[model samples]
Structure formats: structure tokens, C-alpha cells
Target: MKHVYGTTALLVATVALTGCGDSDAGPMPGMNHSSSSTPTSAAAAYNDADVRFATQMIPHHQQAVQMASMAGYQATTPEVKKLATAIKAAQDPEIKLMSGWLTGWGKPVPTPSHGGHGGHEEMPGMMTEEEMSDLGKQQGSMFDRMWIQLMIKHHQGAVAMAKTEQANGKDPASIALAQKVQAAQTAEIATMQRLVGQLPVS
Candidate 1:
């Protein structure tokens, strides 16, 4: 009976020691028990350039999304439709992503201007009210041709903006996104240039 008690006490002591050791170790580095409930600090670090990149890119992408949506009904060519779908797919998420960054960084998200160019007429690749109206008026093969031309120019502006962000933006996430934008838009620009030639002028 004494041996049994001694063995039981030893087992309990071992468990207690183990538990104490675990307690002393505390939470592992970078590990959070309530991580799901906690907001991540990954976006905590940012700068003026990062803020500007996110702010500017939001509206730029919004316009691109607008243009892409128009291709649904306006463009007659399958390739143009496909390209427009892809552009919308790519830019829409990016707009949300950049908007999130701006919000997290405590920066004000740029509201899209209604009717007019929203004072973004001077912004690279931004279409004026007249240009957007003109594009909207076109249909069938004419829209395909004009959209390809205009989108190519629009993509060029986005690429330029991405390059600037990559060069000047401080946040790693912003810079990485800018690099992705540059490569993707550059490829799309090439595709549009080729597509425009095949589209009928009328």
C-alpha cells in the first residue's frame, strides 16, 4: 500500500512539474491564443508613399472596373469580352485590398467622383467625362475597337503608377502589389495592342 501511494504521488508530481514547465514557457513567440479575435498588426507599418499609392490606386482601379463592366454589353468581340472580364477580376479585388490598406493605415479612402472625372482628370490614365461618354456611346465593332484602344492607354497609365509605387512606396505589401500590377497590366497592354488591329474600325 505504501509503495502504491509512493508511485501515485510520483505520477502526480511529474504531471505538476510538467504543467509548471509549460506555464513558465508561456505562449510561443508570435503565437496568440486569441489570434482569431485579435486584429493583425501586419498592416500597422506604413508611410506617406504607401498611403498615396493605396489612395490613388483605389479610384484608378474603380475606373478600370467601370470600363470593364461596360465591355459586357458594349464589346462584340469574344476576345475583348474575355479581356474585360479578366481586367475586372484583377482590378476589383485590388481595389478592395488597397482600400483595406488605406483604412488600416488610418488614411481616408478616396470617394469615387460621380458624373465628372472626380478631379482625377490630371491623374494618369484617367478618362475625362467626355471620353467616358464617348466610349459609352459606341457599340458593336466600334466599341471593341475603341475600347481596346482606350484600355491600352488606360493600362499604360496604371503601369506607370505601379512603377512609381514600386519605386517610392514604403510598405512591403504595397510595393509587392505594385509589382504585380506592373507585370499584369504590361502584359494586358500588349494583348490589347494586338487585339485592336484585328478589330474592325467601324
Candidate 2:
């Protein structure tokens, strides 16, 4: 019985020691590091595709902001103004966000095809010199109807650009921005459709 108990005790000790590695063998020192590789996050692995997407989107969003401001300043309908305000608010921050990404990525900040970022000076879809005069020349239903029609087209262009980015962009941040644009513009499209229904028919 005494011999059997000693054998059993030895076996238990052996099993316990084998279950865990030696305590004295601490993790390797100095230059040695985790054998496990660090995973790159979506924000960390940006490439050229992401750069171009952000660049193109900056100008595209700027154009939308321009159109929205027109509705804000000129449209008589409260609904039109509200929609315009939403668009302007949405696009303005996006412009800054894209600009920051370009800066962070060491890419060129996007410039519009027309020129520098000046106030509503001549942003695309912003009424032209003659167009502005024409908008001013009209009032009430004419202005409201024209504003909604023009903004709907402007938002449509944004949707097109966002779709392109979704399919082609590589960076996580860039893709995220593109997805956001798609979702927001899609919703805005529906709003514009509803507003169009309210406009005075020419």
C-alpha cells in the first residue's frame, strides 16, 4: 500500500509539471518580439486608390455644397431651405474630412476643375453669373421650382461619384467615407423626389 501511494504521487506531480511550461523560461529578451504579426487596420493600409477617391470626392462634395447654398439663400419654401441646409451641413464637413485625409496621407489636396476655394464665387452647380441674375429675376414659385430641380441634379452627380469610390477605393477610411456618401445622398435623393412633387409645374 505504501509503495502504491508513492507511485501515484509521482505520477500526479509529473502530469502537473508537463501541463504547464517551465516558469524559469520567461519570454525571450531584447530584439525578440511576438511571433504573432500585428494586423493593419483599415485606416492604416491606405494606398493610391484611396488617395484618388478622396481627391475626387472633395471637389464633388464642394459642388453639392454650392448647390445647397443656393437653395438656402434663394428658395422661398421652408422645406427647400431645410433640405438645402442639410446638404450644406453634410458636405461641408466631408470636405474638411477628405482634406485632412489627403494631408495625412501626403497626397495633394483636391482642387476643383474651375479654381480655388472661394466663397460661393463660381462653384459648380452654383448659379452662373447669368444664372444668378436670372434666379434673382424670378421669385415665389419660379425660384423654388428652379432651385429644387437644379439641386436634384447636383445630388445625382454626387451619388454617381460615391458609387465609383465604393467600387474602386482601397483605403478603409476612404471606403468608409464613400459608403457614407452613398447612404446620405441616397436618402437625400428620396427627399428631393418628394420636394419635386411639391414644386410649381411650369
Candidate 3:
């Protein structure tokens, strides 16, 4: 009958349109959206904690690198020099890593305030300019002792910050990096403390 044919046609068209609508609606239900246009990963969900961790830690690591660089000429002890080299190697790459994260997250990387090169004071565990200047003036055994003491404090500060990141960060990458920081710095703190006891009182 004409009526039956018309109803069948209408049902077919309705089914076709429904199929098209579903196809256009994006990935199928339960599909991993990360593979498609929507990035539903932890890295994409950078929160305030992640941003703060990156911004604050960059300057902290920069100061560590600066202190480590000073050891090449200022440090007299082989152990101190070795530690400094390791610190530089570890922290310089981390700085770059955090910088990349900030850039990818569309957040501004925190630069040194007042155009101060190596703006260490803006963050905790950062050396004051005067303290750095004093350390710079030292050499031989004196440099070795002061460097160990200062570095211990610096590492402690980094550990504290990293712990905060672990507690508060949403981004998986940032939290992972913070865990690394906490472990590495805490170990370094133990090493520096041992070095402090071994060094002759200055």
C-alpha cells in the first residue's frame, strides 16, 4: 500500500539521519578522547598548583646551577666539585623541562623580577645576593665548607616545595617532576650534611 511504503521511507530516512548525527557527534561512547581532538589527559589539565610549581622551581633550579658552576673554580675538594657538576647536570635540564611545560600550558614563565639575573630571592631556598657575593669571594677549603652549608639549605627548600607540589598539583607531569625533585634533593641533602660534618670548621 502507498501508506505503508511512505511510512517505510520515512523510517529509513529517520534512521539515516540518526546515523549521520551520531557520526558527526564525535568519538563513540567510551572511546579514548585523548587520541582525538580532545586531550583528556592530566598534562592538559594544568591547574594553579602545577603552574606555581613550574614558575617557582625554575628560579630555584637556576640558582642551584649558578652555585654549581662556581665550584669549577672556587671549590678545592674533589667531592664538592663532583657534587657541583652533578647538580648542574641535573638542574639545568629540569629548568628546561619546566620551561617547556609552562610554554605548552600557555602560561608565562616567571622571569627574574627587576631584570635581576638569577633572581634567586623571589623563591625559598634561594641565596641572597650578598650571600652569593660572599660565597663567590671564597676559595679553597673556605669555599668548600660554605658551599656545602648553603647547598644543604637550598636542597631543603627545594624538597619542601616539591612536597607541596605533590600534595596540590593536578598535572601528572608536574607531580611526577615534583616527586623527582623531592627524592633527589632529599638524597642530596643527606650527602651535603655528611660533607658538612667531614669539613673542618671554618
- Please give each candidate's TM-score: 0.78, 0.66, 0.76
The candidates, ranked best first by lDDT, are: 3, 1, 2
Off by over 4 Å in 1: 1-41, 113-115
Assess the local accuracy of residue 74 in candidate 3 as a C-alpha lDDT between 0 and 100.
84
Q: Please give the lDDT score at residue 38 for candidate 2.
A: 17
Residues 1-202 of candidate 2 have per-residue lDDT tens digits of 9999999999999988876555434433211222111112234457777776666667767766766777777778898889889888988887887777777666778666543444333223343456545765667878888776766666666677667777876765566767887788779878878987977775
Candidates sorted by TM-score, best first: 1, 3, 2
Q: Of the pair 1 and 3, which is ahead by TM-score?
A: 1
The true-versus-predicted C-alpha distance at residue 127 of model 2, in Å, is 8.0
Clashing pairs in model 2, backbone N/Cα/C closer than 3 A: none
The total of clashing pairs for model 2 equals: 0
- Give stretches of model 3 more than 4 Å off: 1-43, 112-122
lDDT of 3 by residue, 1-202 (tens): 9999999999999999999998876554433344122323245467898888888898888888889999878898888999999999999888887877777677787654522545455567878888899999987788999999999989989998999999998876677778999999899899888887887765
Candidate with maximal TM-score: 1
Candidate 2, position 47, lDDT: 72
| Stronger candidate by lDDT (1 vs 2) | 1
lDDT of 1 by residue, 126-173 (tens): 887788999999978988888888888888988988888888877667
